[model samples]
Target: MEEERLSQQLHEYALWKADVARNLGLYQNFLESQDNEDNELILRIEDIIESLSTDRIVIAFVAEFSRGKTELINAIFFADYKRRLLPSDVGRTTMCPTELLYDHVSKESYIRLLPIETRLEDTSIAEHKRNLDYWTTLPLQVESPDKMVEAFKEVVKVKRVSLEEAKRLGLFIEDMAQHLEQVPEYVEVPMWRHALISFPHPLLKGGLVILDTPGLNALGTEPELTVDMLPNAHAVIFVLGADTGVTKTDMDMWQEHVKVFSSGGKKGLLVALNKIDTMWDELENSETVASKIKGQCVSTAKTLGIDVATVFPISAHKGLLGKVKHEAALLERSGLPKLERVLSDEILPQKQRIVRDRVINGIGATIKMSRDSVKRNYDGTRQQLDELQSLDVKNNSMIAHLLQMTRKETIIYETRVENFQTSRALLMKHVKEMQEFLNITELDKHITAIRKQMEGSWTTGGMKKGMTQFFEQIRYNMTQVSYTASKANESMQSIYKRFHEDFGLVDIKPSILSMHHYDMRMDNLAKRAEEYRDSTAMTVSEQSFVIKKFFISIVSHARDIFAKAFQEVENWSKSSLVPIAVQLKDSKTALQRRIDNLQRIRDSKETVEGRIDELNQSLADFEARLKQLNEVCDAIHKPLSFDQPPAEAEDIKQQTAS
Candidate 1:
């Protein structure tokens, strides 16, 4: 029964991951054409949508130094973990934030990480010698557990003074040095803001992601990681030492930082009174010491207005033996199991309900985002339509006006081109200057120790090659990812920006303006996506919102006409609108090309994930096949020596001689 149930869980995780992948593709497509004013807000929405796919229930277990955070996780849920025990050496098992992920792929186990500021390939020992600021912002995938462990050993041992070390470098400022002093002494990833330890847990692999972060002060606090990562968590097991009680730091972590999310957000704080084994070693009356500590932990939780489930008194160092009497009871009382139930049986299902709400929320959210994006095309179209309204376009009267304008513009272009040529040169120079802000290649060197372990594996070789090929394709695709129904409308914006000095044509300039919807093509692509999405939203429903169907129909019809006008980038110089219209139309074609490319990639991913699903069954099949082979190959007795072979041959020879 349990085997079947586990198989079901594995299956569900696979489906869940696939569903997320599908949603991610949707978000990726939505994000591709973001070429205008509302992009920042759109990006935030994109972030929410993106998080919905990956880090939905990121329950981070954070604590101060040597408080037994790993032990606490192990104590509550070690029975069915990928391994029998959590990795603990010397004192701390985690020198970084070890994220325990329930990887829907590779049902067995995986430990992954996104490095602080380095891409994998560029990160090498030599790079570390240069400086800390050279790393890229790209995500880094750590190798398998054994290899990651080897690399981690080196990362922890590096002798260089961390950024914190420099900041706290004043030899006399021992007391004043706040963040930096924690780095030189602590065993965690010395320089990084957060070190990730991602693996498959028995319980969490069902649907949980248990993050074991290093001691807070020693690890260095990155507000982005906390701000982005923590609030998304479903529940937080804030582990503290029962023996030590709640320190000022611990109290601050709970009261100030943690409470921010407890209201309407999915995240909440739960205190764990870990390392209760130390109570037995006390010279002061052990019972009194234990009781006093437990009371304080409860008091701390009460101060925050949360139920203190159980102050678990555990000896995580005891190595999986039966816990002490008090510890065992505390384990039963600890809110982890309750918390797990809340996540799986209730919260998880609740989240599913929201997602499966007949795709209403997803459809609404996506459509709303799309309409706002496409509004620019409407504005441009309206301006052009008003220009045409003055002359009846259907009678070919406006065509003459267009011809006149084009001829007039032609006369001015010679001078405009001369001025434009110089400005364009200056703009290009400034662009190169701004491009220098992008160099993070130096940061990769510090993490070089990890790259060593990735060498010479068959799968690793294939993955490296595959990723290189993928990135190559991405480089090209990024240049022309967005599609539009009208090319002419987009070309106008491009033409306007190209010659204008303010639009950046000549010098080494920072593409800060480019950060906005600088790409006319991108704008057109966004407009196309928005048109489709809005058309979807405005579909005649059983219930009518605000405006009745008649007005909405008129507006909807007007919007389409506006879109047509918007796309008509009729070059006044050109006789027909065909040239620019064809260019805008290419966006649609461009969009289709991208979709085709993305579809092919999706098919490949689907196959890979499908193959990954068959792994356990394949493993079981392989095990049985090996067992059969072993039985057949068994030499229970002795080998067929020369003596035995010769006797059989000699008997045959004797019979022939006789």
Candidate 2:
């Protein structure tokens, strides 16, 4: 029953994610129907929807050798397989950071392994996945579990490598060399860079991505997994053996990699003390066993400098057996229920909220802007219709009043045109200011300074600090460009209002400054910079070169982004005030028409009445559309709850408890 409940929670999460995607698609379709007038808004919403579509809740398991990471995964998610899904035996099993996901499009079960030699190529695993020729494929036979187990063992394949080769591959360190007084002829190295296992597993099929990371050696060698994959996962489960407590390697992993989340204020990191069943038989009293487990949790938490509440003592082996055999007592004593609760209740909800906020904040802003523009158009049309209805062509006093009003309106329109010229000059000045903010010369200087810091006397610690500062400067400048864009938006809006109020300009939509894109670009650059810093495989020289190359590419891309923004601003500034100029011309034509109509009032009365009726009809239609747009905007801004229905996420503690 507990297992079924967990499955139901996953199903609900899938439904919620689908709802988000559907609503975003609806909004994008509505924008597209507007004939691409709001290109900036439409493109941004499209990007958001695309991101949400591919988004999956990735849960990563990290630990040293024989900590039962794979077994834990099997117990929590893959127990329905009825046999060991991944090779988890006495010796080394998982040799690469294996990712398990369901590829629905493929609809076939297989494991694809990338050649270890591919690391020499300058491409990411994500890029490598796109090219099938680079991977070795092993198809799984669903009918035969024994054959599948044998096929899975291919992941642990290794070849002897000379010490020189190992050093060149960034696998050797001083500590290992010191222990090896006699340099061995060769050392066994993983044959694959990465292993991708795709099967129709229940949890995986429900938009869940599981990253089963290998031991320390594999993580130390694979910079991409250490720096990018693990950090970006929705949740990271750091497993430690309860019998051994926190070893030196576990502490190193915590401080060097897992602790990096502290800076981001992320709460998805959890510590699991596995193999607790080993302590079960050490004492006879049930209370004594409970005290010992609590002691281990506290000791492990203190050693790792994490909250004791975040640590869970679990026996994955026992838990797997208990779930498979329906032994509720064994499953309860194994302590897997608490961990699963944290996963379904805590981590999943956080992911949902993050995705929900991103969609609502981005799409809601665009909808509000469009709605406001439409409302302004509606109000302007109504005012025009009212003025036309009030015009009395028979009264001479009314003729005088209309003539005087036309002159006043014309003067105000002419004055607005003059003010727009001044605003255009100011707009040019701001454009130059924004361009200066993104100047590459200053960025190059920053890069040169960082290069010097690394090339000179430097420790790894100092180099890390220098890299952080370098990226900080990059972000600072990028932020300045975004800030200036906002100012430009304000300037354009002021002009929009003057034209609308003084010159009777209507239907002028907000110009697309795209400041949000700038913010997103900066965030991506920061994430990449942090990833590069976390890398453990690269040599000091290699790290330096990689950092420099990354920055250079970012600067180049920054130049292109800023250049496009500048061009758009220039184009928008040129045309933003044209409505006022056009209005002035119309006013002059209307003044001449009024003067002639006074002499032929009898003849022109019917034509004037027809014009008034047309204005009234247009105004009525505009108001109706404006009201519909307002309702759409209201629905978007309405607050949404991210939690699942409590009954569906029902507590399974009683069934799984000891």
Candidate 3:
């Protein structure tokens, strides 16, 4: 029953993520339809849409060897493999850090391994991620678990090497080398740098990523893992053996790799005290064992600088066995339920909240601004129609009023056209400035200068810092572009205000003139620029080729981003007031018709009615589009809910039978 409940929880989470992705697609479609020319906004929306579609909930398992981290992962997510998915025997099973995720694109199961020799180069893992040719791929026999198990053993395969060679590959530390001086060959190292597994498990298919990292040595050697991957994970579950308590290596791992995530005592970290079944033999009763485990949790929490509640006591072996056998009592005793609840209820929702906030801030804000601007235009037009509706054709005063208003509106139109030209020039000026801002010539020069400053020490760490500096400069350029955009928007709004406030002309503020829309786009731009940091999380040792690739890729990406943004600004500056200008032209035509009909008021009543009908049709078209804009806006703000899935008829029958 507990297993079924847990399965239901995972199913609902998957459904919710899928629904979110669906809604994101709808938003992308709406944005594309409206602003096909505005590439910046489209690109921003596309990025968000892509992120939503491929969103993965990464749960990193951090622990020393023999702590049953791999076993716990199997119990929680991979029992459906019907056996251990990872090699988790009595000895160290996971020697290389392995990432298990479903590759929905290929729809095939395989493992990709990076050769350990690559670590001798200066390329970061982030760079290697772009080139699949660098990794060795092994196909899994999905039809037979035994064959799959056999293939999986490659993750733990090791090769013996001389101490000097081992040290060169970052496998041997001086302290360990000193202790191993008596041994001729001091190192037995894993053949792979990293292992990437793609399997068709339901949870993994639902975008659950499992990172099973090797113990202290691997974490210590992999700077990118500590700096980027682990820090960026949604949650890090540090598994500890209950009998061993918090060992020295575990504390070191906690302080160096895990504690950073929980610096401010954040909720994205959890500690699992595994192998609690061992405690049962020492304690007299079940209650006593539970008490002893709780005591261990407290002691371990204090040692790890976390709260006792964060330390969960569980037996992965028992949990997997109990869950497999459908024994509720054993599953309950395993303490897996409490940990699973925390994940489903707290951690998953937190991830959802972060994604929701981004969508609301970026897409939702843009839609609201667009909808409101359209609504304002529609309301103003409807008011003019209403005034025309009530005016009597026989009234000479009405004709005079209409003529005077039309003349003023004509002046407003002329002034707006002139202001638009000025805004266009200003936009062009900013676009040129932005083009310069994103130009890689200066960036390349700066990078060259930094490389010179490094004096050929251009080691991985040196270049990594250089990359960080490079991204910072890119961020600065993006900031300048945003400031220029904001300035242009301010000019547009000022021009709009003169028409409405001074000339008493109809409100002509275009959606493009609205700062809210630009602000949202700029915010998204800044976010994408910030994400470049994540992309740079390449391990320093990959090779200098990675730096060149990263530089070109980043420059090209920047050009696209800024080019799209500048084009949007140009488009807005040129065409923002066009809607109001057209309306003004129509207003003038209507007034001219009214004036011509003034001499023959009673006779030209039919013509006046025709003009009114035209106005009504125009208003109707605007209102319909306005309705669509509002619907899209509503969808953006709508809160997502994942109500429980309805029970199947067979399940209900089985329950009744039981």
Best by lDDT: 2
What is candidate 1's lDDT per residue for 167-218, written digit by digit as tens?
Answer: 3321112333344635344222334333433344444555566666666443
TM-scores, all models, native as reference = 0.39, 0.75, 0.76
TM-score, structure 1 vs. true: 0.39
* lDDT-based ranking: 2, 3, 1
TM-score of 3: 0.76
Which pairs clash inside model 2?
none
Candidate 1: lDDT over CA atoms? Answer: 0.41
Better of 1 and 3 by lDDT: 3
lDDT of each: 0.41, 0.69, 0.68
lDDT (10s digit) by residue, model 2, range 174-242: 455566778676877788879988877677777688999887555555655655687679999989998
Worst 10-residue lDDT window for candidate 1 reads 540-549
Q: Which lDDT value does model 3 have at 73?
A: 89
Model 1 error, position 54 (Å):
4.3
Candidate 2 Cα outliers beyond 4 Å, as residue runs: 1-10, 104-109, 130-133, 140-150, 378-635, 643-658
Which residue pairs clash within candidate 3? 121-541, 122-541, 122-542, 122-543, 123-541, 123-542, 123-543, 124-538, 124-539, 125-539
Quote the positional error of residue 74 for candidate 3 in Å. Answer: 0.8
